[model samples]
Target chain A: MAQTLILEGNEGYVLSEILKLSDAQHPTGYLSNEEYTKYFLKSVKGVSNVRKTLAQQINDPTITNVGIIVDANSKGTKARFDSIKSTLTQYLPTVENWDYVASSPAGWVADVAPSFRVGLWVMPNNKDDGYFEHFLTELIAPEDESFLAAQEMLTSIQKSKNQRFPDLRAQKALLALFLAIQEEPGMSAVTALRKGLLRHKHPAARLFVDWYENTFTLG
Target chain B: MIEHLTIKNFLAFPELEVPELKLINLVAGKNGVGKTALLEAIQLYKCSDKIGTNRLISENRKGNIIHHKDRIFASKLEINNLSMTMAVGDYKSKVFIDGEQVEGHGHPDDYPNHEYEFIRSGIKEHDWISRRWSSFVLTEKEELVTEVISKVIGLNIFRIAVTDQSIMVKIAGAKNPVNIKSLGDGLMRTFQIAMALVDSKPLASNLIGLLLIDEIETHLHHSVIRKLWKIIFEYAIKWNIQVVATTHSQDAIRQLFYEAAANESYQEKVQVLRLQIGRSGKHEVIEYPYEKLEFMMDTKLEIRGL
Candidate 1:
C-alpha cells in the first residue's frame, strides 16, 4: 500500500521534518518540485504537467493514496482548491462532491476513484492568503523571545528607507532570520525543525497533522 | 483505420472497449492483461479465412484449434462498419457478420478488403522472411527496406539477396553477401519490421492496412528502437498503414513519444493504450492521447501500467 505526498519547492523537506516531529507514520513516497519542476505549479504548463503526474498516480494500482500540498499564495484557498479540483476532474470526470469538500477549511480527502483516494491541502490552514513560510511561522515557539526579536527586526527594516526586502516576502525573510540565530546558523527552516527549535505541538501544527493523518490514515 | 473497437468474450477479455485509434498506437499493460490478445482479436476481425485464422491464432499459442462452445470471440469495428463474432468449437466454427451468418469461409460482399499483417514476437524463420522477401522483391520496395535497415543498424547495406537456404546482405566493403543473421538479432529484427511495414501497403490506394507487432522492441537496442520508430512513423503515414504494437519496454514507449514529438504531424498520429483490470474483475483501457503522453514523457512519469 503505497501512499505518496507531493509538495511544491522545498516543502517536501519541511513536511518530512514535520512528519518526524508529529511521530506520524511517513508516506511511502515523497515528490517535490526539485525532482519534478512541474510540481512548482507556477504556470499553465506546470499545472498541465502536474495533471499528467496525477493521471499516472491514479492509474497505478500499487498506489493507494495521493496527497498534494500547494501554497494558497495570492489566489487564496478557494481558488487554489478549485484549480486542483479542476485538474483532477479532467482525469476523473465521475468524481463528485468537490465543491462540498472545498467548503471546509481543513482541506479535502476522499476516494475519487475505485481503490484510489486523493487528498488536497492549500497551505497556511487552507483558508488564508499565505504560503509555506507563513505555515512554518505559526509553529515558532510563542514564548521564545528571539522570535519576537526577529519580527521586530523585520518590521524595523520594512519601515527604513533602505529596506530591500519587499513586504510580500517579509514572512520568508523573518523565517530566514529566525533560523540564522539558531544553534546551527544559516540552516534551512526544515533543519531548524529537525533541531527542535520549532514547537511541533503548536495548535497550528496539530491542525495540519490532524488533516494529514486522517487524509492518509497514518494511524 | 479502426476508429473504435469493442470486444466481448474474447481471450482474457470478457468485455473491452477501446477508444478511437490513431495512425500509430502502442498497447501496454502488465503480464496477463491481454495486450497480445487484443492484437489477435484485430487479426481475427480482419481475416477473410476464419478457419485459417483460428488455426493460426491457436498455433501461435501452441494450443489446439478446438475450443469450447462458449468461448466465442466477438468484435465490432465502428468506423469500418463491420462486426464479426466467431466460435471455434469442437464440432465446427461458426461466424456471423452484423448478426447474419456467413456460409463457408467467405466474407460478405460489403466486407472491407483491408490488408492485415501480424508480426509475432521474436525473429521470423528463414523461410518465412525469404517468402516475404521474394514478394517484396517483386515490388519496388527493396531499396526502401535496405535503406531503412542500414540507417537503423548503422550498417551501410548495399544490397539484400535471399538464397534458397538463407537471406544474405552485402555491405559497402563486403566482398560477398553475408548471411543476414550474421549481423545480429537487431539487424534481422529491423529487416522483419521494415518488411512487414512495406508489405502491408495495399495495392489499392483507397484500401487501408493494419500492422500488428507483438513485442516490437525484441532484440533491439534502445537507440536502435528510436531510429526504427522514426522510420515506422514516416512509413505509417506514407503507406496509409495503421500500426499497433505491444511492448513491455519503457524505452520503446519513450522513444515512440520522442519520435512523434519530433514531428508535429506525427504527434496526432500517435497514442498509447494501457490495459488494466478494474475492481469489478473486468479489463479496462486508459488512453493517453498525444498531449497527455507528451506530458507524461516530459515529467518522466511511468506509462507502462507498472
Candidate 2:
C-alpha cells in the first residue's frame, strides 16, 4: 500500500523541490501504486484553513505513514515541535519525543488502530528557530561575494536608519534580495531549489534530506 | 441500523469495502465513478421479491450480459453481526445469512423480503403514491403525512382531498387546490420520500431498516435540498432507519456537513463517503467524517475530486 505525506502549506513549490531531490536520491520505488489505483506521492495540505482536518488525516485508515513539514517560524523549533506533539498526542498518545541527533532524526512514530508512522521536520533544521527562508539562507556559500555584498548593503541601509527592524527581519530582507538576483527572481525556496540556485551539496540542505529519507524511505 | 458494507466483484466494483457507514450517508463522486452502481448493489441485497437468474444477470451487466468476464460478484451488508451476503454467478443468484440460504419475507416460499426502498431519479408516473395518498388522507395518518411535508417544504399543506379519479393537495401559498402532479417534479420528489419514510417507520411487524436512493436531491433547488436533508435526517434518526444515498450536488454535501457538525447528536450519524481513483488506478472509497468534510468545505477543495 502507498503511504500519505502531509505538508504544512497549500502551495506546491516547496513540496515539488523536496520531491525533485527525493526522486533523484532514491529513484527506485520512491512512489508505488496498485493495479487499479494510481498512488502517486500523497500529501495533505495543512494550515489554519485545513487544521480541522489534520486529526482526520492522522487517523485515516488508508494512510501508512504521515510526514509533516512545517516552518519553525517565530515560535522556534522545539516549541513548534511541542505544539504539534501536544495536539497529536490525543490521537497517538504513545508518540515518542522529538530526537534531533539520531541518524534519521526522532519522529513521533505510533503503532495503534489505523496504526501508522509519524515523522516531522521543522524547516531550517528542527533544532533552530525562524522560517524556511532562514534554512534556505544557510545554503549561501561562506565565500560568495555577491551574497555577502547584499547582506552588507542590507545591514548598512538598516544601520543608517537606526536599525528599525530586528536581525531576523533584516536577514529575510537580505535573502529575498539575494534570491531576486537569480533567473527566477523572488521565487519560493522550492523554486530556487528546483533551478539549482540552492546548492543541494550544502551541509544544511543535507540535514533535511537525511531526515526525509530516513523517515520516509528507510525501514 | 446498517453499519458496514463489503463488496467483491459486484457491478462496477472489483473489490470495494466501506468499513464505516453512518445513518445519513451522502456519497459523491464524478460521473462513471460507480455512484449509481453502489445503490444498485444495495437494491440487489434488499430484493425481497424473486428475480429470474437471467434477468438479474442482464440487469447488472455492463455491455452484453453474456459477454465473457468474471461472472461471479458478491455484496455483503452488516447490521451489527446480523449480516446478509448476496452472490450472483453466471445466471444464478443466491442470498445467504451465516452461510445458510435465506428465503426471507415477501415471496411466501422463495425470494428475499428486505424492508427497504430504492428511489431512482428521472420522471416516473407516480400513480402509486397518489392512490396511497388518496386513502391516506381519510385516515388518522393524514396528519403524519402533513407533518413530513411541512418539515420538508417549510410550509403547511392546508388540505388533502382524494377523489375517485385523482388526488387534490393544497399548500400554504397556492390559491386553488390542484392535483398532486400540478406542483411540479421537485415537489413530487419530496412527497415521494416523505411518504416512503412515513410508510417505512416501525410498524406492527416491521422496522424500516434501510433506504437506497440514487441522487436523493435531484430536481430540487439548493434551498430545498437543505430543508429536505433535514427532514430525511430527522426521520432517519426517529425511525431507526439507515439511509444510503448518492448525490452529485455540492450544496447537498455542504448542508449535510453543516448540520452534522452543528448538531451534537448528528455528529456520529452523518458521514460523507467519497468515491475516487486510488493510487492503483481503480476506484476506492474513502470516508470523510463530519469535521473533515467541513474543513474541506471551508478550504473549497472539490469534495468529488473533480
Residue-level lDDT of model 2, residues B104-212, one tens digit each, is 2222122123356666665445466657676567665677877887777776887677666666788778898888767767777877777666665655333445677
Q: Write the per-residue lDDT of candidate 2 for residues A39-81, one digit (tens) a residue.
A: 3233345444323444555444344555667766677666655
DockQ of each: 0.26, 0.07
Name every residue pair that clashes in candidate 1: none
Per-candidate iRMS values, in order, are 5.3, 9.2
Q: For model 1, how does the per-residue alpha-carbon lDDT over A1-219 read when each residue is reduced to its tens digit?
A: 656566654576577567668887644343443432333222223334545566667666666777778777788788877776777676664765556444456678888776677778788778788888898988888778878888888888888896787678788999988887777777787777877777777777877777777677453
Q: For model 1, how many clashes? A: 0
Query: How much DockQ does model 1 earn?
Result: 0.26
Which consecutive 10 residues in model 1 chain A have the weakest lDDT in total? Answer: A35-44
- Docking quality band of candidate 1, CAPRI definitions: acceptable
Candidate 1, overall lDDT? 0.72
lDDT of 1 by residue, B1-306 (tens): 566677775566667888577889999877657788889777766655656455554556654232223443333222123444432211233455444443232223212443577888888788888888887684679988887788788889988999898888999997998998788898988998888877787666755677899988899999999998998887778878888999877889889988978889888888988887753446788888889887776554666453
Candidate 1: segments with Cα more than 4 A from true spot: A8-10, A20-52, A60-62, A74-108, A111-114, A143-146, A160-169, A177-186, A199-203, A206-214, A217-219, B49-58, B64-114, B163-165, B204-206, B279-281
- In model 2 chain B, the worst 10-residue window by lDDT is B103-112
